[model samples]
Target chain A: SQKIEQNSEALNIQEGKTATLTCNYTNYSPAYLQWYRQDPGRGPVFLLLIRENEKEKRKERLKVTFDTTLKQSLFHITASQPADSATYLCALETNNAGNMLTFGGGTRLMVKP
Target chain B: DVKVTQSSRYLVKRTGEKVFLECVQDMDHENMFWYRQDPGLGLRLIYFSYDVKMKEKGDIPEGYSVSREKKERFSLILESASTNQTSMYLCASGILYEQYFGPGTRLTVT
Candidate 1:
């Protein structure tokens, strides 16, 4: 069985500061990893995704780094704002498997002014 | 843009009632999935469909069933809704890579 864990604790940071989120996995070799943002009472929206062979990927203010050796992926948001306060989740999946995605518990980010 | 639309935002049903949760995707995706989101337990996969009329069980499919008579629609059914089933139900469509999720449906079984 595959297991995925994220920073279960809520990350509280001051507005305009960068917030870093971590995702770790064990027992599975995922070919691709993804990140999503979910607001309260809403479904998750896709943010970024990187393959196992890729080291880093970035989009606008968000940057993601993947280390296959460590089986970890880091998501970073620069100059975070109040609107960025939400639950961010990481997903793990393999190419051999169908399009099934396994998600971690997610880390709640709270950006306060 | 791809859009996944869940039938309802919130639903309240009693125990033993048959519940139907509907989802539709405009992207003509080959994969569709249903998952339950609970606090602490994270998201648990309940069922998935590879194509129209093709279904597969997931990790938590014991109490749930699914239907996909059309390519654009997938439905999750609870034969006997239980109180334990009260949680957020999410539907998603995938394109062999990333998945696009609907707005989610909060179901409460009283």
Candidate 2:
């Protein structure tokens, strides 16, 4: 069976510092991966998507790296602010699964002032 | 911007009652999905529709069913609600890859 794992523990970081989150998978090869932001009591909002062929992608102060060989993806938020606090989710879809998205448990991030 | 809307933000239902959660997307996407979110469990797909009247079972479809009579609307039906069915329900619409999510409905079965 395929499994997606994200750090279940909350990540606390000082404001203006970089926050790094990790996502790992096992027993599956995904064609694409995605990141989403979820505030408390709200649905997730799409943030970024990285294809298997893409090594890195960036938007504003955020960046993502995908290492297919390691079966891991790293999400980075640079110059983070208090407003950047939220739970971040990682999702992926394999070609054999008919493009259905599988999401991780998510890692809650708290940016301290 | 793409918009997906769920019928209710919160709901309370009694066990054994029939419950319906509705979702509508304005983007005219080809795919719609239903998912449930529980603490530490992540998002579990309940069902999905590729087109009107076309449906597929996701990983967790045992206690739920779905209806897609129109392109913009998808409904999840709980035939006989149970306490274990209480959770946050989310609906999403997308094309080939990116998906837009609704605010979600928090259903509580008592």
Candidate 3:
């Protein structure tokens, strides 16, 4: 069976530092990959999406890199702030489910002031 | 704003009772989904609807049933609520698979 794995441990970082999160998969190659931000007790909000053909995508202070060769995607948040503290999720889809994403367990991020 | 709304923010029901969790989306999206989030399990899909009066089974559908009568609404039914069914239920809508989620309903079966 296919599996998606994210950093299970919480990531602690300074308010102004960069936070990097990792998502890895085994036995599956999806057509597209996505990232979402989920605050405590709130549904996830869509972030940037990178297709299999794309190497990198950027939005504001966030950047995502998808490397099919490594079977992984890396989500980067630069100039992280206290408000950026939350659990980040990454999903993968075959493109047929209209973006049906197989998500990881998510990595909780806490930005220290 | 494009939004998905669940019928309740929190619910408590007795075991063996029939429970209903409703979801309505304003976006008129072609696809709607039901998911339950647990502490370490991440998000697990329970069911989904592609169109009105149409449905599909997701990874976890054993204890749940769904209803889609109109384009903007989807409901989840727990025929006999059980203690193990206690979890956060989420509703989502989207086109072509990039789903947007509702705030979620935290259900507790006692």
List model 1 lDDT by residue over A18-112, tens digit each.
Answer: 99999999988888999999999888999998988999999999999999899999999999999999999999884376488889999999999
**CAPRI-style class, candidate 2:** medium
lDDT of 1 by residue, B1-110 (tens): 99999999999999999999999999899999999999998988899888899998888998899999999999999999999999999999998878899999999999
Recovered fraction of real interface contacts per model: 0.84, 0.70, 0.76
Model 3 error, position B27 (Å)? 0.8
Clashing pairs in 3: A98-B96, A98-B97, A99-B96, A99-B97
Model 2 spans with C-alpha error above 4 angstroms: A95-98
How do these models rank on TM-score, best leading?
2, 3, 1
The runs of at least 3 residues in candidate 1 whose Cα sits more than 4 Å from the true structure, single-residue gaps closed, are none
Top-DockQ candidate index: 1
Q: Candidates' DockQ values?
A: 0.83, 0.76, 0.77
Error of 1 at B73 (Å): 0.4
- Tell me candidate 1's fraction of native contacts, as a decimal between 0 and 1: 0.84
lDDT scores for all predictions?
A: 0.94, 0.95, 0.93
Error of 1 at B94 (Å): 1.5
Q: Per-candidate TM vs. native?
A: 0.97, 0.98, 0.98
**lDDT per residue as tens, model 3, A1-113:** 88999988999999999999999999887888999999999999989889889999999999999999999999999999999999999988843654566788999999999
With a 3 Å backbone cut-off (N, CA, C), the pairs that clash in candidate 2 are: none
